[model samples]
Target: MKTFKSASAFKPQRQTVVTIGTFDGVHLGHRKIINRLNQVAKTKDLDSVLLTFFPHPRMVLQQNQDLKLINTIDERIRFLSDTGLNYLVIEPFTIEFSRLKAEDYIKQYLVDQLNVAVVIVGYDHRFGRNRTANIEDLKAFAKTYHFEVEEISKQDIDDVAVSSTKIRKAITEGQIDLANTYLSKPFVLTGKVVKGRQLGKSLGYPTANLYIEENYKIIPKEGVYVVCAEIDSKPYFGMMNIGHNPTIAKDNRKSVETYFFDFEGNLYGKTLEIQLLKRIRDERKFDSLVALKAAMQKDKAFSINYIKTLQ
Candidate 1:
């Protein structure tokens, strides 16, 4: 999919169907919205464009914003790129840009700049200065732009609404089963495998260390997890620890170290993707290296058993 950093940079395609949002997680709810966009674009022969945001509007609009994104920019890009979108436009949210009125946004950005033929919006999606443009208001403005607005179905799972906020809350609360359903896949964390202190190697359980680039990406609480790590496009079962290595080291920095079962290679500088299956145990410091190694052995055993159950 083609990417544009801003609408100004996006040259107007002949036919375009645009859906606007931050698309933080691109979760099930977001997928439902995007599905309508794809259908609209396909039926009308319009190019599908995803107009998303960076730093989310809330971060700039609200005071003391505590933004915990479900998907980082990289993750969002990778997710949307696979949906057969023609373009994904990422607009940087700023104070000046936030003040644009609803009519002005539609007139200038969508109609004039993007040359949007049809716009598919979610049921609750609001835009423009102070988020004053509701679906009703947008419909009226759509006539002026000579474009159609579609309100996609609001998705629900088990009678509960599916949303990025709800999914994030579920993950935070260790309700990953529910989060997985909303995500439509296992929660993934992908990064480059970097070198660690060789602490795990010394314990006779060498691990591949991964560096997380986006701080906003949600990580499960500190614990041992049954993980599936992919390296060189090959999947391997692994036991992963997401926490500060307080067992044999003095440091308290959060780290993600995974020991691939019966796998060995030079992983340094290699990119890896990991899917967290389940949490086995919470993180805790051990009194001695011997104690830590024993606990890790137990963790590995639990991970294997867990994988067995999965199979």
Candidate 2:
């Protein structure tokens, strides 16, 4: 698949069946649109493309910066690439770019640049200047431009619409299971393993510390989790604790410490992708090191037992 950072760079000669959205998590609802595009492209023998924005339109348009996101940029790109689309256009969302009128944008970017033959839109998606574009507006633009417009509805679970914001809320409130249900996968964190205090090593449960990325992808509030740790390209059973280390004298830095079960290797500077499986226990400040070690041991046992049930 080809990638273009802006509409001007798009040079596809073949007719394109396109879908536009942030597609942040590419959750179930997004997949419905993708399926629609796939069907349209296959029937029409046109190239299917996805257009999305960086810095999230909200981040560029709002005063308050939202920190938490379900997926990083790389994760989103990788998944979209794997979806068999012909192109993934990632354009920057700047003030000037955001100010384009609906017709101007549809003409300049979609028809003139992308050469779109068909546009697949989500049922409730809004675009264009002042967010005024609706499904009817899109259809009118398609009719005027001699292109096809397909509007796909949101896929719901238990009668509630699945959305990125709702998923974020679930993760924030520690409703990980609900978030996972919406995401169709576990809400995960990816980071680099860094050198740490070696406190877990002292307790015979060595842990790899994580250096978080700047995106501030949401971390579950201080707790132990039955997590799947991916390191050196293999997923392993493990447990992770995220919080200020309350066992020792308190400090200001919050940390993520994960211990790989029945595995030994050099983790320093390696990347770890942890799939948070289930919350085992809330973080607590133990009175002594022995108490902390005992609690960790129990957590490990609980995680192993839980994972075995899944297997």
Candidate 3:
């Protein structure tokens, strides 16, 4: 798929069939829309384009610093890449762009810039400054611009909305299986491996500490989880603990550490993408190092059994 950093950078070689949204998680419902888009583009002999925005609208409009997203921008792009889209345009959302009038936005983006032959949007979609334009307004504009406007049914839009909400809820609650069911894939965490206190090493369960830079990325409930990763093209299964090492440390800083089964290698500077498969148990403060180590051993055994079932 071809990716354009911004709408202005996209020079359409032919008229396109387009869909616009944040497409945050690109969940099953979003995929349904993309499928219809590809079908329309194929039937009409036009290219398909997905126009999405970065720095989500709420982040800019409401200054919602506390808002957490299911997937980071790069992760969203990675998921969308598998949908067989012809083009992707990641437009930067800003206060100035948000001020454009409905008609001006349609003329500037859909007509002049994208040369859209057909525009697909949800039935409840709104546009322009303060979102005053509705699907009816879009159809009226389409008549003036000589293009087609398709509205996704209310049911499909509802499913998309519900799934996004459920996915976030599941992740925050440590319901890994439920979240994966809604997403149709495992919830993933991508970051670099950094040095830790090596407490795990002393306990015979050496771990790789993960450091994620995106503060807005949603983290699962503090607990132990079953996770999988692909390192050097080899698949590895492990158990991850996301919490403070209360049994060993006095500081309150939270950490994510993963201990792979039967694996040993230098991962100090390596970046890893780990997929959460299942939740094991909640993190607790043990009475002693011996008790903590025993609990970890049980977690490892449970993780191995879970992995076997997948095989």
Q: Any idea what lDDT model 3 has?
A: 0.93
- Each prediction's total of clashing residue pairs, residues at least 3 apart in sequence or on different chains, is 0, 0, 0
**Which residue pairs in candidate 1 have backbone atoms (N, alpha carbon, C) closer than 3 angstroms, thus clashing?**
none
RMSD for each model, in Å, please? 2.6, 2.4, 1.0
User: Which candidate tops lDDT?
Assistant: 3
State, as a TM-score between 0 and 1, how close model 2 is to the true structure: 0.91
Each candidate structure's TM-score, on Cα atoms with residue i matched to residue i, is: 0.89, 0.91, 0.98
Prediction 2 global C-alpha lDDT? 0.81
Which candidate number maximizes TM-score?
3
Writing each residue's lDDT as its tens digit, candidate 1 over 1-311 gives 99999989999758799988777667777777677788888888888899988877766778433667777788889888877788999988899889999899889888888998888876776888988888889899988768888776555322224367778887777666677787887777888899887888988889999898877678777778888976677789998888888867667777889999979779898878788888788888888878887898898888888889887
Tens digits of lDDT, candidate 3, 1-311: 88888999999999999999988778899999999999999999999999998889999999998889999898999999999999999989999999999999999998998999999999999999999999999999999999999999999999999999999998999999999998899999989999998878989999999999988899999999999999989999999999998888768889999999877889998999999999999999999888998999899999999999999
Find the 10 residues in a row with the least total lDDT in model 2. Answer: 153-162
lDDT of each: 0.81, 0.81, 0.93
Regions of model 1 farther than 4 Å from truth:
62-65, 153-162, 308-311
**Of candidates 3 and 2, the better by lDDT:** 3
